[model samples]
Target: MTTAVPEDALVLAGGGHSHALVLRRWAMHPERRPRRPVILVNRHSTALYSGMVPGLIAGIYQRRDAAIDLRRLAARAGVALVIAEITGVDSTGKRLELSQRPPLRFGLLSLDVGAETRPSGGMPIKPLEPALAFLEAEDLEKPAGDAAPFCVVGSGLAAVEVVLALRHRWPERSLRLQAFPKRLEARVLQVLKRHRIELQPADAPLPGPSLHCTGSRAPSWLQATGLPLDQNGRLLTDHHLQVEGETLIFASGDCAVIRSDPRPASGVWAVRSARPLAANLEARCRGGSTRPWRPQRQALQLLGIPGSAPQALALKGHWRLGPFRWLWWWKQRIDRRFMAGFQQLQTMDSIDPDASMACRGCAAKLAASPLTAALAESGLRSAAQQPEDAAELLPAGTAGSSWLQSVDGFPALLSDPWRNARLTALHACSDLWASGAMVTSAQAVITVPALSSPLQSELLRQTLAGLQSALEPQGAALIGGHTLEARHPTPAPASLGMQVTLCVNGQVRRKHTGTGWSKRGLRHGDRLLLSRPLGTGVLFAAAMQGAADAEDLDRAERMMGSSQHPLLEELLREETEQEELHACTDITGFGLLGHLGEMLDDDCRLQLDAVKIPSLNGALELLEAGHCSSLAPANRSAWRWLDAPAGKAGPRIHLNLEGLPIGGSRHRALLELLVDPQTCGPLLIGCSETLAMRLESLHSWHRIGCVL
Candidate 1:
């Protein structure tokens, strides 16, 4: 079935441990980076190292110490990262329907999405999403009226950690660990014993053939999707990890129904499959048969507790130590060393441009270096682009309002492939918000470097997904877009940046435009209402250096993912009451106040109530402590101070002040709101009292204001 057309090969789906490790091994032996790989992952990074999860939960380890950093992994491996969830697969079409993309072609496919979670009925706790649940129930909103009892069911590692974590995290809440067994363990027969944790062993199962998963097991989504499954709802797979009957499609991880032998649903077996799975996929890409993957009999284990002293467990035996301060210290060393691999350190590089280093896909992708070079080679002048349709504009006859329009796009500034698309699209849509116009449609220009057909296709799919998500809510539709392959990785569309005229059909458009506005005309005491938070420039630049935390990065990502264009429309409707005059610009590489300075009239005095402006978490602190973004130096050159007793401060201006410091820990609560950037962005509706009330009522975004 392999095609000579170079378009045929295996597509490993998901960043499950097995698949993730397989990618690592494949990269290490890149004579075998799977040629037609279309790695499908729901998350950008698949939080590897589940063993340390309990230690992480117990506050024993930070998220970075526990995560694998799949972004770095994929980059090193030179693989496509299609961040999407697969809902269904059509064998007849050889296509997979992602939650976000059109049907994608797959020659030979394998899934390692992992089994979903099942929760105890009526129980407020969820075992799989333990971290989030714990944060919600115990951390954010504690028991107000009654003590909520902690009840967990299961005996395995996932269960054991939850029990101990609950005890450690919430000592005030009632602790109730209950266990009921139909039959005793075969070894402990005829012996009555008391243990801290209740042991449940049954000779006869709980009225069913399958083990009722109260722990981390198959969620309803798996059953709803209805992939080939056994009676127990486990996806049936062959010895080769290929799904039964559909050998062209494979399954791995705990979700797969590998009935050839009974195996514990442990991450160990998954990790062990790395070598075999990668080899088989590589072999398949080379037009050969897939190799067999065999699970190992045993793996070493570690038990974590949130106590002063630590207890250890493994296949070797149980060993309790007096104090694990030393043990935790040792563990920390090991974890740090393990996490070092995730740094942006590439293992391989080809010297010559036309030199082929065993490419598997249909096209040769341009390395990031060449991509940047091509973007820099653009001959366009430093002028803003204008739309040139022959339609003559009639002045708004002094009676009606008007709408404005402009367009922009750029090469991705992020290293994470999946997030790059999302952020770029978000950056592009910012123009719509800044112009105060509803985005009706978008025309795109995609430039993918020479790469495999599969890689190119996946990139295009991901790009379109990001655009669709950012635009649709504002009634914006991406109806038309053009894609071309080039010598660069930039997705810079031709529709951006040029000597262009902006046309609009609004009263203000015929009246006032983004003209005659300089630092002199802006009056003193004019209030500044930044539409979005700052720190995007700083945080993302920090991420490139691998200094940002996972939670902070995740928060930034989740915030940017939502459509900001709609928030602008909401602000416009909310601003109908007052006319302080709308004067604003969306925050971009120029940073918050840098862009704000551009909209101000010449010789005008302005006041930045360092306290009133909202900021994002960890932004000012990062900024003040010599952690400015890469764009900071460029932004500094744009400033020309006329009159400010604040001494014309630099990027850390948020912290520089005579009265209350804008970047103090006390001010962090407020600054965390103001510094976070909004993609597509919010409207800084500078109306009278209506703006504040509307923002309060909508509650979609945090509001902060200051009068200069």
Candidate 2:
């Protein structure tokens, strides 16, 4: 692992099992960090070993336990980890095409990205992909609203495991299954034959000049590169394990199919390949000749559960080992140890140079979808008539009394309290605006961590300034507010917030509490139009972690700032019109989708134009890339109505919206002209088409997504 850091590149494009050991060796040796060699791993994270696939699928092991943490691993190995996906290599030019980073120029390269199963879906199944089915399975936290069937087209151990995992994940469902050129393995065929399972006899189908999955053969591109591949998709290589035609390019493990020393696509080959692969890389770096890779005649191969316990059919020679619990235990221990390297990384205060972060979630924040969904669900509700019959008919109480109030909160994730106060203030007045009231006064509700009194006061001053600035537009004054010192609260402070929230209560000059003006009284079928776009929930979460670009952050800030006042004035005008525009009142906390479901009327259903709905600058990209606000889960949990079948509306956005939004272009753009709840938030603006258009036409309409 130690040597002069060589600028001459040796690009290792995977973090497969063998490469991991190589990386670990590098990590422990500091020479590897500087000039050792450049290791280009495509996956930013780690890939799990195949042995733990069954346990992971069976829910016995957490995903962290099954997968390796490549980043942490590479870091420990003192190697630069380039987070990218490799498309292909121009070996002739010695350049590699990657999804991220510039096409790398390398002096020597070894690709063990591993083979994928038969291709499926728009996402290409990697050559000999292990999780082809499980990864593609629609174990959609919720049913896909319909029984959306997915396919797996392989007849190998990997394929069987995937199918069983899928079956287990969706216990009560009618799912279709399809396998081409079915019967595989001598043992499997014998069992199926005994159990009356059908199969097309080998060569009974037909012979063809062309290549197909019907025969075990490598695809054209891989074969054309001139790496050894049997007629099957397996990589063809020599006893030395050098991929054919390319001397420097060593292909081993599941990717290879040895000609002279034929071996099944099993761990034995990869494990055997590791010794030489490591030696080869080391020798190449040390300016020495590569060693020959010898494949074992037979080694252990374990089958994952199709319908079994902690059991496996082990392969060694012609003799098969018992499906013993002990074997499973041994396999479990090895896999667990590997995975533990990842999962247990942070606990080791003193970092090992070679261990990569094991948990993707260790540094990850909560998703945002559910957060918006929750707020949106509660933002609007019908109210029942609380009779205006005066409890005090006499003028003893000096006319109707009003209690000016404000409740302001910001997504606490933003570390600065002063900044949070500003955002929180903007959010608080939203309730006053939506309710068609003018703010009379506001106050600070202070909470602080254990700190010096001066620090507390300074914090209080900054917060009040932000609050005052935020509330001024609503014509509210910060009269007074309360504060407390606590470690945490039920609704955490702005530091952890996805979106800022605050409330300012304005007095109704013409108090109408007697009227059933509250949201609980509203009917269903009211078309749900948004005053703001649907990405603040995501944007807030993204901003909290500072994951967003400067433009995105600016857009988010502007969106929150602009959303206030504009909607408030609009609501105030509608209130004066004496025509009750809103049958209910609710702020958008859950999301446009979640809140829309709350007020559904029998004949009135929500119809939306996908493109018509506004989005924050990076919102669309965030949702697509699977970033969501932390609050998303709660929203989804509270509004199970989204689970119902309502045609396309059933699954609002068909994208991976369940997670927190990590703002990208759309979310940033949406934030530029959004009525997101963070700042003043937008009034729900429940009105007729004419009023909706009028609201949409206003310059301020851009602050909130246009009502129309």
Candidate 1, residues 42-67, lDDT tens digits: the string is 44454556666666656666666677
Misplaced by over 4 Å in model 2 are 1-6, 31-34, 99-101, 118-137, 140-155, 164-167, 170-220, 223-240, 244-247, 257-259, 306-310, 324-327, 341-708
What's the true lDDT of residue 695 in model 1?
65
What are the clash counts of all predictions, listed in order?
44, 131
Model 2 TM-score is 0.45
TM-score of each: 0.74, 0.45
Per-model CA lDDT versus the true structure: 0.50, 0.49
Shift in Å, residue 340, candidate 2 = 3.3
Residue 145 lDDT, candidate 1, scale 0-100: 29
Worst 10 residues of 2 by lDDT: 382-391
Say which candidate scores most in TM-score: 1
Which tens-of-lDDT digit does each residue in 1-708 have in candidate 2? 222323345678676666766665554554533243355455435576677765665566665556566655554453545545676677787766665234555666777766554443333334323343434454543564345444433465555454445445544443332344544666654543332334433333322111112113333346545445575667666666666777557666666666778776655566557767777777766766666656556676665443345455576556677556777677677767766654543312334323212111101223334434555678622111121101222243555544334354533433334445665665565555544456676656566654435434444554565577666666677776566775643221122212333445566543344222233233332233456645666654443333433345456556665535655555545443444455334345545544444444443433344455666677666655555654454445533432445564453222222242545554433322222222233445455555555555763443222222
Looking at model 1, residue 253 earns an lDDT score of 72
